[model samples]
Target chain A: MAFDGDQLSALAAVVHEGSFDAAAQRLHVTPSAVSQRIKALEQQVGRVLVLRTRPCRPTDDGEVLVRLAGQMELLGRDAMAQLVPAPGASRAAPSSRRLPVAVNDDSMSTWFPAAVADLPADVLLDLRREDQELSADLLRDGTVMAAVTADPRAVQGCRVRRLGAMRYLAVAAPDRRDRWFADGLGAEVFAAAPLLAFNREDGLQERFVASVVGRRTTTPHVHYVPSQSAFVGLVEAGLGWGMVPEVAAAPLISAGALVEIRAGRHLDVPLYWQHWALRTPTLDDLTERVVRAAAKALRPVRRHGPPSTAG
Target chain B: MAFDGDQLSALAAVVHEGSFDAAAQRLHVTPSAVSQRIKALEQQVGRVLVLRTRPCRPTDDGEVLVRLAGQMELLGRDAMAQLVPAPGASRAAPSSRRLPVAVNDDSMSTWFPAAVADLPADVLLDLRREDQELSADLLRDGTVMAAVTADPRAVQGCRVRRLGAMRYLAVAAPDRRDRWFADGLGAEVFAAAPLLAFNREDGLQERFVASVVGRRTTTPHVHYVPSQSAFVGLVEAGLGWGMVPEVAAAPLISAGALVEIRAGRHLDVPLYWQHWALRTPTLDDLTERVVRAAAKALRPVRRHGPPSTAG
Candidate 1:
């Protein structure tokens, strides 16, 4: 649905702040006007975007449309910037919504948040995470204009660059490692011992185990530790050992809460920086910083390696 | 989704091809309105897109909504280069297509005749192919705006890069690699056996065993042969251990003489490249060369990796 500049800004404020009242105060518009614009936007899309809940949250469909609105704005601004071939493209009129960026949870736990620490405050930041493997889909669907992904391939109009690897280490609490070792923790110990996964869907632990066990199981009594900090906390507390990104875990390990379970065989997830293939300084700058950081921090792999037939 | 540019073309031909009788003969136009609008479009897109399509084409979409009409002329011109851009941006006046390109097979296999090579062929130069992993997608997607690929990434705006990747290999005729030590090969002896994977999937024999046996299927499939020339015919002729990419296999392997039983892992597929993000001469210069070659040579990835997960 197309929205003119004024109308879109008003609606975006209302949605982000969660209320016509709050949005009105922030946008310096009357609450009634904010209500009118949102109603109009909803009518245009033929679906309700805001639910008017206590603090208000968008419906799943509403979020999708809100995302679409955000993309259209980007595209419009980009069009203005590129299509008109002027020396310095006029600045995009400021909007309250931050440029949404989608990234993998692991990267988010590592350098992603830090990447944003450098953005202009007015640029705003919208962060989303799923998994490195699927992050590009967000770019395809226009959920975000930029993304940190495992897939190096570009989306229809996106640019791609290597962001290096996100190395993972198999670590455990110092006492727990010794206990498992002393208790005859053979490979089979993995089949029976308590394992910690970030969530019901997280497979890092299972995959790590299978890499060592040679076979995987469908059922295991697993402790679900959802957040990055929480997952590390659980591991630090010795709930069970899990694979953790070296970046975020190194500092914690030095404090004596955790210890490396095995010294070799790190899992390196190659990461890539992908963004709309537009000629915008902000996007380009973000790409440069990300690529630089990944290069400085992650282990590097030769561009072409001896071919293999294994996953 | 299909537009009736043919009707319009035939009609336009009636006037351009001139003498309703000749235009009708050329366009199979029934003569009446073909004569009428031949005069009309001269007014519409504002230029004579086609003087004739006796096997003829267009003047410009810029003059009007002549997208399909202009695209046909552009594509015909590009049967060689790669693509024609928007109906709007013709610096001075739209003209010919140019610069032929090459690509691999896989990308061509999936992108269909279109995919990345979706741009019209308003320029010149025939699209061609050779490798399947590198520039094929660039050719297909117009990334190199051109390429030859196996499983290589499409050059951003070009067609295919390499077809991306297809792991191919060689297995001897009993006497070839091990002096009749053939059939007894299924177990531990295969990893470092006189193995063959022309480029990389050579450990394939061992990988096959791994699926049938273990993950660290300790086998050493031999050397990397990057060229298709040595990969296939060389392997078929019973040369020392050789692994070939998939595209080169069919004819020779199908003949029932050569046998490749080596198996170890999933072929590694990695494609990469970058292209001019904007529609410019250099970018266009490379696209057609890539896609045309991809269409004729490459194959597709069996499945798109799962729908990319988005936040």
Candidate 2:
């Protein structure tokens, strides 16, 4: 069944604001009016749209509508901006468009801000920092208009472009290397060394270990530090050996704070830019800027064969 | 049916590593051994425990076991530490413990690091940065053992203690204030002005608006910038007016880079320290350090009523 945009927007507001009263305030309507709009929409959809809890949560069905509302809002704003006259010619406020994008934490801490800085002033960015592997879910669910994802496959109704690869080197502080690897970079030593992980989801270090030793073995003693910057700090402080991004590792490697564990082993996580296929000027500009930045900051995608000699 | 600790751990490893092979590697066993352990556990439990996806996700039953495994591991580690001699007396890895804790982004950017600094060298912190309002979800899901949360209510089997209130003031760049509020803080002007939000989950600005206008209403224009530091920068750059934490805004206020939108108007979000009721030395030390830091950094919890003179 088709739903009215206004009603869907009201429903989205309720879910976002958490309470009918707050949603009413956000919508500048009376609480009763907000209630009426939601009730009407729920009736139209013939499903329970929201779970009226302390922080109102959308039901599975409600989520679909909320996602639709967000997508429509984004597309509508972009379309309006395109149709409207230039800011100089118009008497209205400057055309400020909100672009919700999901980004992985590593990129958020490193190259993502530069890409954001490259966007036009009128575009307002709403960045959701999530794991690269999970960022595609945001695009699929319409929570974000675009995402920098590790998933090379395009989400339904989305376009994907290769952004490039984030290369990581297994490194450790000199003290840690001396202490943990006194014996050599064998399977036993790699398995025993205190390894650092970004989080439970992070498998880069484990993958590195598997590559070193033909197959997965006993888990290494691990210290999980989820922050992008702090993960590097822990390695520098001799806390644990970890996979450091090539961009962040270079200066430290040269400065002697960290040394490569195996000398030649590395991991390259290829990243992609995924966005809705609806083609908006804002999305186009953002994709262009991101593609340009990734080209300079990340390893280029090899057309034929693997580029890294290390792995 | 009772499940053995080994089997439970195996299940947790599978869920944690996201694959049987990875879990087998982590458990330092053959993939077949990992499979057999899981198969035995499933037989004992009489339920399908895990959904074998690319990155394996736990079925509802699997999550219960995973949570149990995590809790048992934590308690077991703490018990071992208690039984064992202190670091100087023992050579066994110095009783290193990993404490996965959730903290708000604002806290992470500001006072949280100092609190982390106070943690003992042997206690490794696995910090997860989440919004204060949502951090409790981590505690609930057993993803973290503790959290600095806005919700004062205790999660199941968790203890809650008042940390203190984080005070936020509505502020804007001088030019923004002058241009947007030239006619004063009227509802129309407020509704039209660009506002900054941390993300979609942020309703603080909307709540503040309702408080100012004395009713619920339509949402004002918003620019969502998820980073705490970047949100402040956006406000400073005159991109939007937003509520800035007192700890962060004070220096900018003194520097005349930002002006309080409405004098004395502020929002105080009372934060609490929530942790598993299972008392452990590491958890105790962390709570103590966090509480001590919050006392110095946050506004004291008021005994009676709201303190802000504006609202």
Candidate 3:
């Protein structure tokens, strides 16, 4: 319950590393002390938190303790970020802070670098994108302060801002489209049409098909292309047709090398910027930059969601 | 570059709870000490992790560190789990292991209880769902040792196992369908029809419309129901005709309350099971249980991406 920061660190490391010997090596602590410190904490908690599993384990009760121990590390790091704001500066940033964010792969790989480049040189932005959908779990577990998501609903204690819509188009090589639909590929023809998918969830094909067929099945005629660029390439190679982000598609569409299957129709996935309701100038700045970027990048935006009655 | 567990925990707590005072309360450290601890860490990390603004934020670099800290915590918890094999255990398991798992909402809600019930009492499963589309992300992060992903391509360290297809039926109340589509609905019908969406990621309606029309642009007539059961209930109430998971609709269809829009053909969302190539028994056991559950609950045959070169 009450671990001196060092003791907790030692405990967590020892527990994580399995043997006190292993943890000691990682923590640069002695095996004897590691064992003794754990015993002491076990005594303090009045519970057996760690099991003697070869590597080691925390009991259900131990998990509670370990979770706490883990939390301890998080707090320590936030504290650390403040103490040493800049390497050379003798004075600190007055208040030390840590910004936790959850982002999606597309955003992380394509957009985040640019966004960070726009931030103050000193301001830190921690980006973690598991899935934009599950990003809220970070919030639930008290991990991140902000997230970029397609959902408008806000988590408890958070505010939501519509970022705009990320439109995706189902495109393919002009030659491929011509071949596939030369005689005007209709329903049965689509059943045999070559298709590229972003992994499996790349439902642009499904969404495109569902939009056309009133939501049939994720067409069986599908090839699973895993990466973003590859999915585009597959479409370009005349291997199949897949959904490409409008921003990414703009160049290709203009090149006349790829044809939008359904011209004038795009899947507008509305996105939202959500963050804790707490007023931090830092959060304000992040919110501003993200919204501005989203506005420029996405379209048909509206600041909408269920009534904000909770706030 | 080198943060002992203590520093990481402290930072995590501060950013997570929003204030140093709150973080102190959570970590049971004095506010002054919390302040000092963060000060020390920032010095060590040589960068500002948090914005020190309202709530508090971690810089992008800070977030990377914080994410590392979070993973450290998770690893620490697993370590603890290994130490304590089971209740009242005197020693640790022969090996320490944590099974990272990816799952979706339906499977989680429907079969999770059974799956958990079926698992060995000693092992724990960290199940994550990217709703459906983003489920594969769990594979990418290594956060999950395994996942129930829609995507077939395996991540760098995992193997793919096909489970089965989750079928969805386009169903609605007779009155609603009759009122709207006496001769079948048109493209514009879906745009104005009371479409049901689970979250922003739920693309059932869009897919449905795409089945008939070319693609769905944007639908103004919409209802955002977050809960699965509630979403189905609204559709049953004739709020709008939307695609319902076959599992949820089974009883309703049997009772003749809900009519299938396009009967016989089910929107089969073929599911996949992917796991890391770790030799841990826990991961194997979890995989077995989940795969078994998927086999029983879903329909259609299953297929895997690539073999388990995860080892």
Candidate 1 reaches a DockQ of: 0.01
lDDT of 3 by residue, B1-311 (tens): 56778777778777767788998998888988777877888898787877887777667656655555656765665566667654321122332233445566555445443554433323433444455346554444334556666677876656787788777787787777776566455665555444556555677667766765655566544444444444566567665567777877889989877887656745677778876655444555677777777878877463445321110
C-alpha DockQ of every model? 0.01, 0.20, 0.01
Q: Give the number of the best model, judged by TM-score.
A: 2
The sequence of per-residue lDDT tens digits that candidate 3 reaches over residues A144-247 is 66788766778766788877777778788887677666655355546656566544345556766766655465344454433344445546656567778787
RMSD of 1: 27.9
Give the least accurate 10-residue stretch of model 1 chain A, judged by summed lDDT: A87-96
Model 3 misplaced stretches (Cα beyond 4 Å) = A1-311, B1-3, B35-42, B80-85, B88-104, B118-164, B188-193, B214-220, B270-288, B299-311
Ranking by lDDT: 2, 3, 1
In terms of docking quality, how is candidate 2 classified?
incorrect
Per-residue C-alpha lDDT of model 2 across residues B19-133, encoded as one tens digit per residue: 9999998889998998898899999889999887878878877877777787888777788777875452112354567788888777766666667653554566778877523
Query: Whose lDDT is greatest here?
Result: 2
TM-score for all predictions?
0.39, 0.71, 0.41
Summarize candidate 1's per-residue lDDT along A188-219 as a digit string, tens digits.
46644444665445666766666655677532
Per-residue lDDT tens digits for candidate 2, residues A120-160, read 54576788877623776676556687888777789776888
> In order, how many clashes per candidate?
133, 12, 84
